[model samples]
Target chain A: SQLAEENSWALSVHEGESVTVNCSYKTSITALQWYRQKSGKGPAQLILIRSNEREKRNGRLRATLDTSSQSSSLSITATRCEDTAVYFCAGMGYKLTFGTGTSLLVDP
Target chain B: EAAVTQSPRNKVTVTGGNVTLSCRQTNSHNYMYWYRQDTGHGLRLIHYSYGAGNLQIGDVPDGYKATRTTQEDFFLLLELASPSQTSLYFCASSDPRWGGRAEQFFGPGTRLTVL
Candidate 1:
């Protein structure tokens, strides 16, 4: 079973535009990690925000965590065609449980 | 650089046939995990291990068995393969020493087809 709900299954954005992907989880977690998977490849970690931290940033990627609401969001600024992929949010416990995922397509 | 690899990259097997998926990590991480990915469902964990000879059942462990032969090697076994088990399998490794917030590194993934 998936522990989180991603806002969209597919999203399209023009290059250089900014886009945000929202995720909502059902249970408490020690941390929330975002991952990106390109076609024909496994997922790669984007960012990990601990429960104690409200936000984290890596390059153009920003992740925000709100424990009270059990939600997290990932924002990518200045999107590029290379940024097109399926993004997943995972809630960490003894093991990381992944959400359905948001497929983002950055078109030039 | 941290790296995890799995083999065979793709496989086709018949129902009731025996299948084994292998994973090896060069990162020397203490934690290794196996997961399967389907179209509608994201990724579901099948099993994990904290160290050599240790095994922990994951959320979706039915019809699957795993063994951690060494710190760097893990194998998933399907004694009787079924069509429903056809999916892309991924292998990941993480180190807990990183303040309990280590990020997982994943392999390219193995595509398995059970006919």
Candidate 2:
């Protein structure tokens, strides 16, 4: 749960700009997942990166995992206002633990 | 698409009151999980089940109990609700056979308020 923590509490960017949310975990993880939660909805998985791989991508979303540093990052390219949401990074091994989350506001 | 639904989208209960949140997933996934989300703390797992009649403890299980009656239905019970338990609850289901259960289908979520 608290083992994973996001670096920033919030960030703001304009439309068409790219933004990244970072996370660090206290323990080993087999995989790292980035999830996005919009207002009034549950969190949805965006991308999953394995420890063996350095990066993974889905559509406009990209995820990178650095097992050696116990860190991960999710980057969104050409963000839209609809992309505004709380982003969380989850560490998955025997159990799945989520980071606090970084709220990203994409301004028009 | 995988579908998961939760009942009583909003709930308000007083201290010492009892509350139960219902969830049903049409995904036919074998694993279901219950989690609570709050400011700063993010999502903390309360409980989970691999199948019917099987339950597993999660990160935060002190004030909650859960039961999986069938493959599709899982219920979370709060016998004595407290203000600290006031948070958004979400139900999710996934199949372990898929890339270590990375992708989970989640319900809309139940907003619980305890006074």
Candidate 3:
């Protein structure tokens, strides 16, 4: 069974706009990770938020974790065309269980 | 730089044929995983290994077998391939010591077609 699932299957926005992807999990997790996969490429880790940490930021990317709700959110500020990819949220426990993913398209 | 490489980037085989997918990681991580990605199911773990000579069944381990012969090498075997098995396969490695932040490094992925 999938432990984590993204709220949106697809999302579109202007290049300069900001976007947020929400994810919810069903079980307790040690941490939640956000990953991005470009066309024809493997997924790469974007941000990892621990259970104890409510939020984390890296450059224009911000990730928030709400353990009380078993939910997480990833926000990208000033999106770019290069940001077009599929984003996934993974719940970390004994292993990483990935969500279906959100396909984000940043139109120039 | 740590890296993972998979051989036979693309493959085609007939039903009941045997196939082996190879993965090698230079990261020397203790955990190696095999996952398959389909249209709507996203990525599902097929098998995993924590060390050489150790194998753990994943959520979807049926019709698949895996062996970790060495710290750097992990192989997934399909003895009787079927069309339903056709999908993109990925190999990943991670160090458990990183705690909750252990980031899995993935290979480019192998595209397999079972006709």
What lDDT would each prediction earn against the true structure?
0.92, 0.90, 0.94
Task: Write the residue-wise lDDT of candidate 3 on B31-114 in tens digits.
Answer: 999999998889999999888999999989989999999999999999999999999999999985873237888999999999
Flag the better candidate by DockQ, 1 or 3: 1
lDDT of 1 by residue, A5-60 (tens): 79899999999999999999998889999999999998999999999999999999
DockQ of 3: 0.61
Model number with the top TM-score: 3
Instruction: Tell me, by lDDT, which candidate is best.
Output: 3
- What's the TM-score of each model vs. the native? 0.96, 0.96, 0.97
| C-alpha RMSD of candidate 1 | 1.3
Over the stretch A69-105, how does candidate 3's per-residue lDDT look in tens digits? 9999999999999999999999998779999999999
Please list the residue runs of candidate 2 whose C-alpha ends up more than 4 Å from where it truly belongs after superposition. Answer: none
CA displacement after TM-score superposition, residue A8 of candidate 2 (Å): 0.6
Q: Say which prediction, candidate 1 or candidate 2, comes out ahead on lDDT.
A: 1
The TM-score obtained by model 3 is 0.97
Clashes of each: 0, 0, 0
Screening candidate 1 with a backbone cut-off below 3 angstroms (N, C-alpha, C), the clashing residue pairs are none
Q: Which stretches of candidate 3 lie over 4 Å from their true place?
A: B99-101
